[model samples]
Target: MKGQSRRRVLQAGAFAAVSGAAAGMTGGRATAAASATRPTSIPSARKSGGALPFLEGAFTPATKELTAFDLDVTGKIPRDLDGRYLRTGPNALGLEDPRAHHWMLGDGMVHGVRLRAGRAEWYRNRWVRSSQVAEKLRETYPGSAPADDFACNTHIIGYKGRILALQEGGPLPYELDGNLSTLRPYDFRSTLKSSFTAHTKYDPAADELHAVTYYPTWDHVRHLVMDHTGRLARTHRIPVADAPMMHDFALTGKYVVIVDVPLTFDEQAAQAGALVPYEWNHHHPMRLGVMPRTGGTVRWFAIDPVYFSHTLNAYDDGNRIVVEYTSMPAPFYAAGLGSGGPTATGAPTLDRWTIDLTRSHVTATRLDDLPQEFPRINEHLTTRRHRYGYTASAAEMWRAYETVDGQIPDTKFTNCLVKHDMLRSTRQVRRFPAGAGASEPVFVPRRGARDEDDGYVLSYVNDPDRGATDLVILAAQDFTGHALARVHLPGRVPLGFHGSWVHDA
Candidate 1:
């Protein structure tokens, strides 16, 4: 059979099997399934036999929805700062089998901190209400029903007056209010026919949002663009051999960088009940394609097989396209999402790939040897040469767990936030407290700022000792100095994926 027909058959078989299983289950079993899907107040304490690394420490989910006003602040918040810092991540409420729970398979929970005129207005954390969540809470489903009812976790951003909670691999974006309340599943006013991605690049020059999205059930991915008015303006279908997990992509002045890594969908793994059924395939060729932003034939360049979760930035430099990102060795090699210690290829590092248009070749280089991930740069520099980039230390984040065989010791911890000066070939690090962990650093440029680094870096630092998280603001130009301000939150904010600084309009 052809690949498309084979995929359709497989999907049908899986659906039938699930339907049969549900039909055959007793009332108790049905109750159990419902219970498993509900969000718990807090994660249970770690078991004596060893627990999942993500379930403990800073990765634990907040117990309940919280709303706090007049947040305590240390130092002074910039008077010019005005907007909300919103983030979302997997926060598992209840797990039937904690041992089998993957870090990326949890319910979606969004955390937000509102800032205005030098004051921390409020901090709120709310779960994005999927159908299951709404059913469990005995409430009506919010907004338009999604094509799929999976949690829209991973990243959150504000675009065209809409705050969207996004996820990868086949879920629609959930819309939230300015106060972080789940409004409904948004689909560009019914313009989107396929799934949306967790990451979307905004081109200020064109006033549009671009994304490369993928779904496991499809044999191809799509390049989607939304106009400045929040309308789905374009969709380009790109064919591929297999269903690759394109978690994130990059956008430059001329092209949208589509990375096809070694990680592909595993039908066997899915049938075997793996929560995240994608794994590394040694046989799969790793490559990247650069497609013209305005839509044209894609230029493909083969690269070494590797994995990366996020891209810092990409831009055009003469005839060469420069892309900087965090490179990892493998995915789910040991178990779960980035569980187990570092692989033989070493920890995740800041790497660069220069695609030469003239030579039709790609040159890979290591920009920084430091183990780091969750890279961010000034949004104003998107699709342009940028001087500074920021990343959270991955030294402790990824190496926190021992191998499944228990060969290495579990020394789970969090480290510093880093500022890299690409032009100067130097970096300044700001280490957090001993037991504290920080989320991805978001760079918010000052209003009417002249230089690229003239902004404030914002992060949610989880302080285990205090059982709370703080939104830390650092002067971008003064990287190693004391924080400009720390807005102490009332509850814990788990280490999450990505977020954006939504400026007030």
Candidate 2:
């Protein structure tokens, strides 16, 4: 059984490494009167667009129907690293790369899961065998063709008994040690980016290891502080304006917290870049910034006028600084210009937000709307927090029409899984009425289930007009009432950008 669950997660990390409470639960300390006050100054024109006040309806549906499970393991979802900005479609039925491959794509194997006695262990991110990306994609695209779904982009963090692995396509910062698979090369002067697309953060109390990158030809946010054997101790720069970037960032101790989203290179080249010259007329503004974990000075906070497609989780809820986004409502600038103008024919309402960085602003919430003529927002759905609190997944926009025989909304779209409970703030929208395909969810946590509010949530729903794909499971405390089973899968597996669940002991 996987060598007795990797020796019971190395004997429960040698009994929690002598009980420092799992290294203070992955280390992070806050308090200097909560980072020396000074929060409250947000409104760089709250992005204008007044008239939108209507709160009251925090989700309520659970009539009763909970029971889910179907961990069918088949496997096939990982391919994309050719970069000319990577593009491929027509086969695998029309693959489309969703936000950040594995969301940071690799660094301690994208820290996903690791339980043990209850069981689960999955790791992927191959191509180190004297690398050369499939012989340079067959000697420079001699008729392009390579997309059998490979996988990597960060992962491998076991601690105490050791297991590092965070090799970002080699430039610096590499370590693979699942108990000694020994793939050396760990330098760490930071600013490293050959492809593991930065988004890492570890600070077992200053043992340090942070990351950030996003230059877009100098919009600024280079920051990289390392240690814990990776070396490089500091590097700075955090000036943000037409590039509020950083969709995900957090580090409690010295306080990092970056949850930005002010991007508009003509709306990132109208939904997927291609006009260059740094988006001529520029207009990327989504805000929430804070810095100081040793690189002083930076404090931005603006909200309203959102249009984020994914990733936005910043925390430190010890008196506010929550942040969690997945917003929608802006795209009609020729629908982000995928060619065809008139804001590319409008429609995309889906809303969500919850910022409060100590009162700097933000509190718009209104999930349940994506029929605005398919404006697209299933950018791989992801927003996390657990122990029984927040959870998210919402990508519904089907519209398949060849002359329509049934499925139709924009031609077959699916993505639904929304669990929330910000201390009873409400929310639980699950789905499977026979349609779903956007994948990016994995929240096990049931072992010793005496009702720790029960738990289970794995996903990867597909049907792309019936090529087929499934691996569903839900019921994290009755997610909107029941779906608990589905394991189909024999072909078609493209819909990946993030996955993690390595627990089996």
Candidate 3:
């Protein structure tokens, strides 16, 4: 049965690559140390004891709190009575207030849902008719719209008591007014098309609010300052030469940092031994660019990025600006063989870098040596004041690349989280149990709570043997190895792409 299942998966993967679904489909693992790889199968329900074994001497808060819920949304395709298609799942919603009660916005896809603090009751109805946006998109993209409800790709942000949302494909700002039940939707699509990523930032010196734009395809960043009334105040067009085709960015008080991942079709084609068309090779770049928030000229530099930085993804921590990355070089196999050939070979590297803005210098460091066991870092998990926290993933994972000679294939990979100290250049590392998936850990810090240790670290561990993903909530302060709570997810939360924290009331 195992052998038969492995063959079926390999066939599906080959078909998927030909259909161009390779990029969107994630979370595939090697079936066995010797067998080939396949898309991970979701497991049935199971329970966990809530103990994370590796968080030793990491966080020592006064209390361990489950202030907010780490909701997971896995996409399920279902057919309607008329045999139409539909998608259902939870998305990453941005919180608008200090209170954990309301969620200001919803992503409306597998991981796109969000809400305003204290507004849990708002999602009871679909006030913003997704049908309307669907019509607009159908007219624009033609043939791309599928019948049934589609994802809006919305984002919620908070600034000076005001809440706003940037829908997925456009740059229109809607006045949320802390109400999702009767949301006052305005037609602001004329301002911009295809809003890849959005954030509400404040300029203290000017006492102004800024709504930023992330262009994922073309690799550009734009800023539009708006008054309290939601009126556009000023527009700044910032051009980037080496921004990642992936469109990830960060913002500080005085500067905006743009990062570009260097995954290009040309490189893939070169490795695949085929000639890829020019249209597919446009956005690839291998560099990072720094620009002043006020917008004059931009300065670009090259860096081999391994993973993305946590919240603010890029930030200035007093002395230096640190951009954390997971380092994995393009293996010779991928470059030599392409999609139809053998798998990539070699170990991966996960490390962080401190870029000195003042002197235009950079320093790289490894995160494997900290005192704590697990360090959590991603686009969403960052210290409130950008202090010390954990960094995960960005490390390397290896798998069986190919079968050679008359000998069996030998494969090895490492999955560990690090507790990194930004100020002192130190980190602690912890390895997960055997046969667990390499997923980032979610750290929820306690705010305004009596017991400082009352925070919980939420993570999903995919047990390949059992074919299930377990949700483990551990005491944040008990990084020295303690268990607080554990539960089983109803289904697998397809390895998350990113996460964030919404503090409590």
- Residue-level lDDT for 82 in candidate 1: 96
Q: Write the per-residue lDDT of candidate 3 for residues 1-505, one digit (tens) a residue.
A: 1333222211111110000000011122212121111212221111122211111011000010011123332321111101101111112122122121101112232211122221211111122224333342242332332222223323344445433333421334443343232143333324333342333444444566554454323445566665554455567776654322232355555566655445322323223333211112223545556667676676666655443322323456775666654433342232122222223333333456676767777677765432111233332323223434654431212232222221223434344454555557655555665445434455554444344334555454444444444444455556546444333232333322233333211
> Using TM-score as the measure, what is the rank order of every candidate, best first?
1, 3, 2
User: Which wins on TM-score, candidate 1 or candidate 3?
Assistant: 1
> Which lDDT tens digits does candidate 2 get at residues 123-155?
111222112222422323223221211222223
On residues 83-125, what C-alpha lDDT tens digit does candidate 1 reach at each position? 9998877767655556655555667888888999899988877
Best by lDDT: 1
TM agreement with the true structure for every prediction: 0.88, 0.26, 0.52
**Candidates sorted on lDDT, descending:** 1, 3, 2
Candidate 2: regions farther than 4 A off:
1-131, 134-137, 141-254, 257-291, 296-312, 315-415, 419-424, 433-437, 441-461, 468-495, 499-505
lDDT of 3 at 80: 11
Candidates' C-alpha lDDT: 0.72, 0.34, 0.35
